[model samples]
Target chain A: MTDATPTFERSPDLPPPASTVGVVGWLRQNLFSTWYNTLLTILALWIVWEAVPPVISWAFLTADWAGTSRDDCTSGGACWVFIKEWFGQFIYGRYPIEERWRINFGSIILIVCAATLFFPRFPYKLWVSLFLIFVYPIVAFFLFSGDAFGLEWVETPLWGGLFLTLVIAIVGCVFALPIGIVLALGRRSDMPAVRAVCVAFIELWRGVPLITVLFMASVMFPLFVPEGLTFDKLLRALIGIMLFQAAYLAEVIRGGLQAIPRGQYEGAQALGLSYWKMMILIILPQALKLVIPGIVNSFIALLKDTTLVLIIGLFDFLGMIQAAGTNPDWLGFAVEGYVFAAFVFWVLCFGISRYSLHLERKLHTGH
Target chain B: MAVSSEVGTPPARASFWNDPRIRAIIFQILILGGIILFGIYIVNNTLVNMESRGISSGFDFMGRTAGFDIGMTLIPYDEASSYGRAFFVSLLNTLLVSAIGIFFATILGFIVGIARLSNNWLVSKLAEVYIEIIRNIPLLLQIFFWYFAVLRALPSPRQSFELADTFFLNLRGLFVPKPIFEAGFSAILISFLIGLVAVVFIARWAKRRREATGQQFHTVYVSIGILVGLPFLAGLVTGFPLSWDYPALKGFNFQGGMTLIPELVALTIALSVYTASFIAEVVRSGIQAVSHGQTEAAGSLGLRPGPTLRLVIIPQALRVIIPPLTNQYLNLTKNSSLAAAIAYPDLVLVFAGTALMQTGQAVEIIAITMAVYLTISLVISAIMNWYNKKMALVER
Candidate 1:
C-alpha cells in the first residue's frame, strides 16, 4: 500500500453529510461566497432598511390606532382616523347611517352560513346550506332594502365599497360555478354545433377587456333592452363581471375534466350510466376536487377585477379611496389612502391564496 | 346496456341522430334564422338612429384632421394631424410601456423566482413578501399611487436634479441625452450587423467542432470579442461618429434630451413591478417542474454548478417556462391598458376614452381597440403555441 499500487481515491458520487451539505452549506455557497454576494447582501439589507421602517411607521408605529375624526389624528402618520370614521360606509355602504344593524345582522348570517358550509363536522350540512342559500337573498333583501316590511327602501345605488365588492364577488362565484360546468361540458361535447356555440360564447366575452364590458353594461345595456325597462348600474356591472369570470372558470374546470382517466369514462359508459348520471354521480365530484385550486385562483382574479367598476362610477374600496382622497380637507392624503386600500386588497388575496394552498394539500392527488 | 331504452329507440340502433337528423336540422335552421334576423334588426335600428341624429359614420372621419394637442408623441405630431396619427401615437406609447415592462419584469421575475427557491431563509421570505404584496393589490391602484402620490410629490422643475451633465430629473419627467446621428453612423451600424453575423457563424462552427472533437471552444468569449471589437473598430474608422446632446437648463424646463413624462415612467415601473410577482411564480414553477434527477446526473458527470444549471437545467426548464412566461407577458400587455386611469396616454385612454367621445363613434372605436388587443393576443398565442409544440415531450 505504501508503494502506491494504483490505490483509487475515487471521488464520492454525492455531496458530504448535512453539516457540509444542505442548508448551512448552501448559505455559505450562496450568500457569503464571494465579494459580489457579500456586496449583494449589503445592498439588499440597505434596501430593506430604507423601505421597511417608513412603511411600518406609516402603517402601524406612531399611527393613530383609534380615532373617530381627522382632528383626532395628532400623530404624523396614516390617518386611520378617516378609515375609522368611514368604516361604517366602507362595510355597509350608504345603508342609512341609523339602520346599520340590519347590515350587521345580515353579515352575521352570511358568516354563520359560510362556517357551516366549510365545517365538515356540521350536521345536516348540505340541507342546512341549501336552506340557508335559498333563504339569505330574500332575508338580506328585506333587511337591507326594507320597503316591503315597513322599513325604508335602501337603493342598490347606495350599496358601495367593501360591502358591494364582497357581495358581488361572492355572488358572482356562486353563480358562475354551475354555469362554468355547463359551458365546459358543452365545449367538450361531440356535437360540433354545441361545441362551436360554447367556444364562441366563451371566447367572445374573454377577448374583450372587462372595462369595455362594464361600460357596455352601464351605458349601452339599456339601449339593448326594450323601452321603459330600467336596470340598476350596480346590477349590470355585477352581471358583466360574472359573465366574464364564468368564461375563465370554464377553462379551469375543463382542465380538471381532462385529468380524469379514459378508463373511468369507459367504465361509466360500460355501467350504462347516462351522460348526466355519469357526470353528476362520478365525474363532476372528482373533477371539482381536482380543480379547487384553479377555481380559487379564478376567484382571486375576479376579486381583483371587481375594482374595475371604480372606473365605471362605482365606489368600491379603491374608488372610495380615490374619491375620499380628493376631498378639500384631505387633499394630500392620496398616498395614505392608496396604501391602505392596497393593504386591504393584499390581505384578501393573500388569505385566499393561503387557503388555496391548504386545500391543495388536503386534496392532493399526487400528480 | 340501457342506451336504446333511454333513447326510446329499437334495439341495434346505430345513430343517435337517427331520424334523418331532423332534430339537428331543425335546431340548425332555428339558429341561423335567429342569427340572421338579429343581425338585420341591429343594422336597421343603427341606420335609422344614425339618420335621425343626422350623423355620418365610417373610416372617413379617421383621415380627418385631428385638432387637439397631445401631451406626448413618439413622432412629430401636431393638433392639425389626422386622428389616425393621434391613434398611432397613442399606440406607440402603449407599446413602449408594454415592451419596457416585459423586459424588466422578466429579469426581476427570474431573480425573485430563484430567490424563492434559495435555502437562505431571508431571501425566500423576502421573495414571498414581494410576490404577496405586489401581486394581490389591484394594478390600477398601483398606477394611481405612482402617478398621483409618488411622482406628483417630486420637487418642481426649477430644482431639477442634474445627472452627468447630460440628464435632468424633475416632477415633470426624467430627461436623458438623445443621440443626433451624423453621416458616419450608418456605416458603423452596417459593421455591427456584419460583426453579429460573423459571431453567429463562429458560434455554430465552434459548437460543431466541440461536438466532433470533444474540445471546448469558448464560443461565448469569442462571440463577445468579435461583437465588441468590430463595433469599436468601425467607430474608430468612421472617426468616432457619436456625440451626446446634453439636456441644457432652460428658463422653466430642461430643453432637448429626449423627455420622458412622469406618467410614462410611472406606468412602466408600476406595470413591471405588478407583473413581476406573477412572472416570478411562473418561473418558480417552471424551475421546480424540472426533476432533480437531471441536475444530479449532470453534476455526477463532472459538470460544475454553473455549467450544470446553464447546460442541463435551463434548456429543459425553459421548455416549461416559456408557456407561462408568455402568459405573464400577455397579461402585462393587457394590464398596461390600465395606464389610462393615470392619464398615461396609452391606447385605451386616448383611443377608447378620448377619441370615442370626440367622434361619438362608440361602435367603431371600441371595435378597433378590441381588434388591436385581439390581434396582439392571437399572434402571441400562435407563436408561443408553435414554440411549445416544438418543445413538447417526445416518448421516443
Candidate 2:
C-alpha cells in the first residue's frame, strides 16, 4: 500500500522540536520553567507594585501642584509647591534674582549648541562643536557673572546649584583630558626625571579621596601658593578636582595606550611622523577610539563625584537639594528631594552609559 | 653601532642648535628655573601674608591636647589624648570600613555576575536593575540617603529595638554581643595558625603528587577539615576559653557591645553596592571570554556541569577576571573616602578634616594621608598582580 515495506528507518526525521526556541518558548523556559522562577517573578512584580504605587501617590496624587506659597501643601503627598518655590534657588543658587535670566539665556545657547553635537542629523557639527568648545564659555561667563559689558558682577560664592555641577563637570572633562594625556605619556616616558616626577604626582593625587582634595583646595591650597595670589574658592576647588580627576583619567588613558599594539608606535616612527604628529594623527586617534567606552564610564564617574563638592560648601545639584530640604519650611522632604536628585543624576548617567554601549557596538571594528 | 663607541665625543655631523642632548639640557634648565621661581614666589608671599594677618602657625597645637570628642574609638582615647592619637583612631576606622566593604562587595559582585548570566529572566533583570541604579547615582547621595533619611528616621534610644536582651538596634547603631577571650585563648589561636600552616603545606604536597601521578586528591575537603576541625579541637583541649560579653540594657541605651555605627554601616553598604556593579561586569566578561568548545569537549567526556565549570571554565575565566576585579577592589577602597560627606570618621574626615584643621600642616598631613593610601594600594596591587601571574593559563 505504501511502497510495501519501509526502509527500516525508525522515525526517519529528527524528533519534534522542543518548546524552548522562540519568544514564547523563551518565556516559558526562562520565566516559568521552575516554580521557583515563577515565584520570584511574582514576588518582583509585587515589589514593583507595592513600591511604585506609594511613590506615584506621594509624588503626584493628593499633592500640591500649584500656588506661590508654602501654605498650599497639605502633606498627604509630596508638596511639589516646595520644589516649585525653590526651583530658582535650585537652578541658580543665590544668583541675583533679576539677573538670573542670563543663565536661562546661556542655557538656551548651550542647548542649541548641544543639540548640534548630540543629535547626528544636525548639519555643520564641526563648526557647532568648535563654537561650543571655545565661544560658549565667553558668552556664558559674560552673561552669568558679567562685570564687563556693563552688567553687574555676580560673585562665584553666589554662583552655584545645578549650574555649578554643569560647570565643574564640563571643566573637569576638558581640563582633565589634556593633562591626563600628558601625565599618561610622562608615566610611560623613557626619561627618568620626567617619569619619576609624573609617577609621584599621579600617584599622590589618585591615592587620596576627592573630598580631602576639595578640603585642601578650600583651606590648605591657600597656604601652598602665595597668600596674596589667591584663587576663588570655586576656582581652587575646580583646579583641585581637575588635578585629582586627571590622575584617574591618566591611568585610564594609560591603559588604552598600553593596549595599542607596540607596532602602531613603531609603524608611525617608520613613516617618519614627528612625536606630536604621530600622537595626534596616528597613535592617539586609534588608542582613544579603543578607549571611548572607558572614557565615557570615567566621565560618568566624574559627574557623580561632582556632588561631593557639597562638603566644601559649594551648592552643586546635591547641595541645592540638601539646602532646600533642610530649610525650616520643608523639613521633612529629605527623602523626596534626594530621590528627585537621584532621578536626575540617574537619567544623565544612565543615558551616557547606554550611549556608550551603543557606541561600542557601532564603532566596533573587532580588532 | 660600533662607530658610535667614541667616548665623550659628539657625532661629527652634530649641529649645536639641533643637538638632542643640548636641547634636552636647555628644556630641563627652563623647567627647573620655572619651578624654582614659582616656589620662591609662593614662599615669600605666604610669609608676608602671615605677618599681615598677625597669625603665627606651627605644630604647637598638637601638644596642647585635642579638645574634641570622637564617638567611637578602638583605642584608649580621652580629652588628654594628643591630636596624633585622634588621627590614628580615624585612620583605623577608615581601614575597617574599606576592609568590610571589599569583602562584601566581592561576594555580592560574584553572585550578581552569575545571576546576570542565568537562564532565569527575573534573576538577570534584577541584577541588571541593581547595577544600573546603583552605578548611575553618586555615592555621596547614597551615603546622604542612609544617614539623613534612613538612619535619622529610626526611633531614638528610648524606643530602641531589642533583640535577645543582648543587643539593641536604634538610629545610633546595631549593638551585638562581643566576645571576651580568656588569656589562655592564645594557646588555641597558636594551634589554629599551626593548623593553617599544615594545611597549606599539605595542599602544596598534594598538588605536586597529583601533577606527578595524575591522581585526584580532595585537597579542599582536607583543608576545610583542618581549618575548622583543628581550631575546634584545639579550643576544646585548651578548656574552651572564649566567652561572650552580652551588652546589658542600661538606662536608655545598650551599655556595652560591639556597636556598628550607622555611619559605618551606611558607608560600607554604599561602597559594596556601588563597586559590586563594576565587579559584576568584570566577572561576566571573564566567564564569557572562555571558548564554548572547552566546555563542550569537557561535557562530551561525560563530565557534569559543576565539574566542567570548575575544571575547564573557571580556571580560564579567573585569568581574565582577577585583573579587573582587583581594580574594582582598589576603587572600592578609594571610594570609601567619600565617608567624609556623611561624617563617618574615616581617615579623610578625622585626619584630613579635624587633624589638618588643628595642625595647619597641609603639606605634611596630605602627604601622610596620601602615603597611607599609596601603601595600601601598592600592597593590594602587588599581591593581586602576583596572583594574576600565577593563575594565568600556561598555554602551549
Candidate 3:
C-alpha cells in the first residue's frame, strides 16, 4: 500500500470565461439564443419603433395640452385641450359650481381614510377601519346629499363624472363584501333551507346581465315599491349593483372556504365552540385572508361594472365623457374625451390590480 | 383524559329552545315566512302599479310590430316585422359578433401567451406590456376607445384607406369584397364537407396507428390538402362557382360590398383585445403549471422540443387552460351586452331596448333577454364541462 501511494495535483482557480458572464452573455442567453429569437427581437423592436414615436409625439410634443377651446387644437395630434377645458365637467358633471367644494371635502375624507386604513404600521387599523366602514357612509351621505349642516341639497341626478363613479363603486364594494360573506356562509350552512335561499339568490344574480339588472332597477323597481313612496335612482342602482356583485364575491369567498381543510371545522367543534364562534375565531379569519386576492379581483370587477350606470341614465365617469363629447362646443373631441377617460380608468384599475398581486405574493405563505 | 371522560359520559340533553336542530328549523321557517310575505307584497304592489300606470305585461306583445329599426342586424329586419323577429335578428347578431370575437381572441391569446414565454427578451417584454395594459383597463372603456377614437378617426367613405384591392377602411366601417355563390356551388360545398369528414377520420386513424405502433404520418398536410384542395378541385370542375362582389364608388358612398359596420367592428375588436389578455394569462399560467420535469424527461428521451411540446406539454397544459378559457369566453359573451351602449343592436339593444320601449313590457322583455343569455351561458358551460371531463387524466 505504501508503494502504490500517489501525489495529487492542484490547479489554481481562474476567472469565468467572458462568454458565460456579463451583459453580452445575458443578451446571448435571453435575446439571441436562437435564429427565430433574433427575428422575434427585431420584430418587437420594429413594433416599438412604429408605436412609441407616434404616441410620444401625439401625447407630448405635438399635443394641445393647455388650451380653453377646440380652436387651440391646431396640431395634427391629440386635442388634449378638450380634456383641459372640460376637466371640471369631467370631475363633477353639472354638480353646482358653488357646491363643488362638498365633493372635494368628500374626496379628501376618502383619501385620508384610505391612506390611514391601508398603510402598513398604522395603529388600531382594524378598529379604525370598522369605524370608517360603519360610520363614514353616513358622513359621506350627509356631505354629498347635503340637507343637513345648513348646506344645499344636491340631488343624485347632478351626481355625475368621477365623483359619482367612486360613489357607486365604493358603496357597492362596501355593501357587497359583508353580504357576500353572509351569502357564502349561508351557501355552506348545514341548514338546507338557508343554503337553498342563498343558492337561489346567488344564481339568479349571476345568471342575468348587469345591464338588465340596472334596467330592472330603473324601471321595474318602482312597481315593487309602495305607491307614493319612491327610491332614489342612485340608491336603486346601488341596490342592483350590490346584489349583483354579492353573488360574484360569494363565489370567490366560497372558493376560499372550500380550500380550508375539514380538520379545522372538526377541531373547532371538538373545542366545544358554537358555529358562529367557531367561524369567527377559527375559520373566517383564515378563509377571508386566503380570499383577499379574490375579493380584490371582484372589487375591481365591481368598479368596472359601475360604468353600466350610464344605461340607467346616470352620469358616471364614462357617462360624463359621453355627455361632454356630445356637447356642441366639444363636438369632434370624442377621441380626446374617451382617451382621457380610458387613461384614468386604466390608471386606477391597473394600480389596484398591481396592489392586489403584491398582496397575494406577500400573503402567500404556502399552507 | 378529562375531555375523553367528559365525552364518555353522556351529556345532559339541552332544552328544545337550545337545540340546534329545532332552532335551525325555526330559523328556516322564519326565513321562508319572510320570503313568502315579501313575494306576495311585491306581486300585489306590482299588479296595482301596472294597472294604474296602464302598463301591459305579457308575451302577447311579442307578436306586435316592432316599429323600430335595428342597425347591423344579421337577419332581415324592418319596421313591419314582429317583435319576435326583431328578437331573433338581434340574437343572431349577438351570436355572430361573439363567435367572431372568440375566434380572433383565441388566436391572438395563444400568440401573446406563447410570446410571453419566449426566449427573446424584447418579445416577452412586449407581450407582457400588452397583457398588462389591456387587462388593467375596463372593457367598456376599451370599447369606447376603439369605437370613438380609432374607428371614428378613420377617413370617410370617399377617402377610404385601401388594404389591398379587396379591403377598404372608412368611417362607415370596413368594406370587404363579398363572396357570392353562383349555380353549382353545392358541389364545392359538399366536397368541403366531405373533406372535413375525411380529415376527422384521418386524424382518428393517425392517433390509433401512432398508439398501436410507433409510426408517424403527415396527417396535417394530408388533412389540409383534402380539405382545401378538394374544395378547389370541385370548384374548378363546377366552372368556378364562387364570385366576389367588390365595392366601387357609386354616387357619394361605396356600393355593393359587405360592410362591417363600425359598431360591430368596434365591439369585436375591443372584445377580442380585452378577452385575449385574460386568455393569455390563463395560457401562461397553464403552460407554467406543466412541471419542468416533464420537459426534461421528454428531452432525456431524445424527443425534439416541438414534438415534446405537442405531445407531452400541451396535453397536460390543456387541462389547466380549458376551464379558465371557457370562463373568458363566457365573460366575452356577457360583455357583449355592452354593445347596447353604442347602439350596436345586439340582443340587449334591439330586444331589451327597442322592443321593450315599443311594448313597454319591462318585466317580460327583460326576462326574455336574461333567459336568452342564461341559456347561451349554460350551454357553453355544459360543453366546456364535458370537454374538461374528457381531458381530465383517468385514474384507477
Candidate 4:
C-alpha cells in the first residue's frame, strides 16, 4: 500500500540478434533448422542445380526459333521452327485457309461475351450471359458450318485443331449445365421412379471411361438410329461428350444442393412458392453461386477430355499435333509439337483454375 | 362440442392435377413411359439396322479366334487364342499397368504431399511447381511425349544404355534382368510368410503386455529383424538358390531378360505422374485438415514430432485422405483406357477396337468392355467403403 519512489529506468529494445533477423536468419529457421532439414535443403539444391540450367539452355538459349523447315533446325537444340512451320495446321488443322476468319470472329465474340460477365457495372450482365450460354452457340455453329448464313459451307470434317477443341468444350459445357441441373433435381426428387432413373443414368456414365462412351457413340450409334439417318461425326462425339460431362456436373451440382441449408427450403415453402418457382428464384441462384468453382473445374476437365475425340478420328488440338508429329517431313519434331501443346494446355488450365479461385474468393459471403 | 366438430370435418379436396401425390405419380409415370418408349425404339432400330448391314450381334463372337498379336501380355497368347482369352490378356495388361501406376503414384504422392508442407521454403515451392505443371498437362499428351519424344529418342539396341550390366534401355523397351528362381526358393517365401504371421502375433502380445504392465516394447524393430532375418536364414539354408538372367547384347537386339514394351513404360509413367499430382493435393488438404491443436496437444503430452504425426495426425488425416485417394485410383484406372490411343493392346484396343472391327459386333464388344471397367470401379469403391467404415470414429 506504500507509494515507494525507488525506481529504475527501462532500457529501449535492441534489434534481434543477427542469426534471427535477416535473410540468413530466415535460411537458418526455414532451411537448416535441423539435421534432416539441412540434408533435405542440400538435396533440393542439388536437384535444382542438376535440372534448371540444362532446361533453360535447351529451351531458350540454344533453341532455334526463326526457321521455316526441318533443315533450318541444325542447332542440336529444341527446334521451335517445326512448331512454327505447322502453326497453321496446329491452330486450324486442314481448316480451309480462306475460311479461318469465321473461327476467329466467333472466338472474338465469345471472348467479348465472357468479358462482360466479369464487369460488375454492366447493366445487361444477365442478358449477356444468357446469350453466351444459349444463343451464341447456335450463331457460332452456323458461322463455322456456313450452311445457314450464306457463308461458305465448311463441312464438319474440316473442323479441326484448337477451333474444334473449343467448340466441343464450350458446347459440351453450355448444354450439359441445364441437363446436369435437371438430373441433379431428379436425383433429389421425392418421386421414387424419377430418382431411380436419374441415379441409373448418372452412374452409367460415371462408372465407365469416356473412351467407351465415344466408341458407343461412333460405332453403335449408327445402328441405334434408323437406316440412312446419318449424323455428323463431330455431332456424335459432341453428344457423347455432353452426356458424359452431364453426369459429372450433376454430381457437383448435387453437392451444391446438399450444402444449401434446409431453412432456405422451408422459408421458400413458407412464402407459398411452388417447388419450381422456389428453385428458380431463390434456391438455384445461391446453390449455383456456391458451386461456381466446381463448375469451372469441371469445364477445365471437359476441355482436357476433349483430346479423347482424337481416338474417334476428330483432330482436336492435341490430335493435330499428333498427326503433325507423324508427318514424314516433320518426322522427328514430336518433341517440339508436344512441348508447344503442353505449354498451351498449361496456360489455359492454369488460367481457368486461377479464375475459379478468384470467383470463389469474390463470392464467399460469411453466413 | 365445437372442437369435436372441427376435428370431425374433412378438409376440402383439391383436383387430381393439383394434388402433389397424384402429380408426382403422374410425372413419374410419364418419365417411365418416355424411357420405355425410347428403349423400344432404339432396340427396334438397332435390330433392323443390324439385319440390313449383315452384322450379327451376340456374345457368341467371344468364342471365335482373335487372330491378332498383342505386344505385351501377362498370359500366353497368340493369334489362335479365343476372343475371350484375348479379352483376359488385355484386361490383365490393363490391371498390371494400373497396379504399377498406383504403387508408384502413392509413394510419389505421399513424398510430394509431405514436402509441400515442409518448413524449407525451397522444397515446398519445388513441390508446388511439380504439382502445378504436371497436373495441367493432359495424360494422353504426356504419354505421347514420353513414348514418341523421349523413349523413342533413345539409342538403338546396339548402343543401348546399360545399368551395371543387368539393365538395358533402348528405343525398343526397358530390359531388366529376370530372376531365375531355383527349386528351393519356395523355402524363402514360406519363411517370409511365417515371419509376417509371427510379427502380428508378437505385436498383439506386446500391446497386451504394455496395457497390463504399463511398459513399452520396441515391436517395430523386433518385427523388422524377424522379417528380414527369417528370410535371409531360409535363403542361406537353401544355399541361396537364385540366379539372374542378365540382359546381354545379342546379335540384333538384347535377349534373356524381361522386356517392358515402350508403350507400357510410357503409359505407366504418364498415368502415375498425372495421378500423383492430384493425390498430392488430396494428401496436402488432408494433413491440413488435421487441426494444429492436435499437434500442440500431442507435444504437451510429451510426444515427439515424428510419433505425434504417425500416431495422431496421420490416422485422422487418413480418414480424410482415403476417400479422395480412392477417387484418384479410380481415375487412374479409367484413364488407362487412353492406352488405346497409342495402340498399347489394352482391353479397349484388343476387344473394343480390333475384335469389334474384325467381327463388326460393335454393340456386344463395346458393352463388354464398358462392363469390365464398371466392374473394376465398383470393386475398388466397395473395398474403399469397407475400409472407411472400419476406420470411422467410434462414439460413446
Q: Which candidate has the top score in DockQ?
A: 4
Cα TM-score of candidate 4: 0.97
Docking class of 3: medium
Clashes of 2: 0
Reference-based lDDT, residue A251, model 4: 97
Interface RMSD, candidates in the order listed? 2.6, 2.4, 1.3, 0.8
Candidate maximizing lDDT: 4
Ranking the candidates on TM-score from highest down gives 4, 3, 2, 1
**Could you give candidate 4's per-residue lDDT for residues B248-289 as a string of tens digits?**
888989889899998998998899889999999999999999
Cα lDDT tens digits, model 1, B276-327, are: 9988898899899899999999989999999999998988899989988988
Q: What's the lDDT for all of these models?
A: 0.82, 0.84, 0.89, 0.92
- Fraction of reference contacts reproduced per prediction? 0.33, 0.66, 0.79, 0.84
**Native contacts retained by model 3, as a fraction?**
0.79
Q: Runs in model 2 with CA error above 4 Å?
A: A1-24, A34-77, A119-123, A259-267, A365-367, B1-12, B43-64, B162-167
TM-score of model 1 (CA atoms): 0.90
lDDT, residue B328, model 4: 97
Query: After superposition, which runs of candidate 3 have C-alpha atoms over 4 Å from their true positions?
Result: A1-20, B1-14, B205-218
TM-score of each: 0.90, 0.91, 0.94, 0.97
Candidate 2 C-alpha lDDT tens digits along A1-367: 7898778766688744667677868888888888888987787678778877988888888787888767877767877777778888887888889998888889999887887687878779999888887888788878887899999999999988888898899888888988999988888876666777788889888766677678778876677665557778899989999998889888888888998899989999999887789889987888788788988988998999999898888999899999998899778878878887888899999999999999999878896
Top-down DockQ ranking = 4, 3, 2, 1
Q: What is the DockQ of each candidate?
A: 0.35, 0.58, 0.73, 0.85
Instruction: Provide a comma-separated list of chain B TM-scores, one per candidate.
Output: 0.91, 0.89, 0.93, 0.96
User: Model 3 — TM-score against the truth?
Assistant: 0.94
- What is the C-alpha lDDT profile of model 3 across B1-396, one tens digit per residue? 678876796778999899988999999999989999999999999898888889987788878887887777676778898988998999998899999999999999999999999878889899999998888777888888899878988988889999777798999899999999888999999999999999999999999999999799999999989999999999889899788999987877889889999999999999999999999999999999999999999999999999999999999999999999999998899889999988898988888887777778887888788888888888999999999999999898
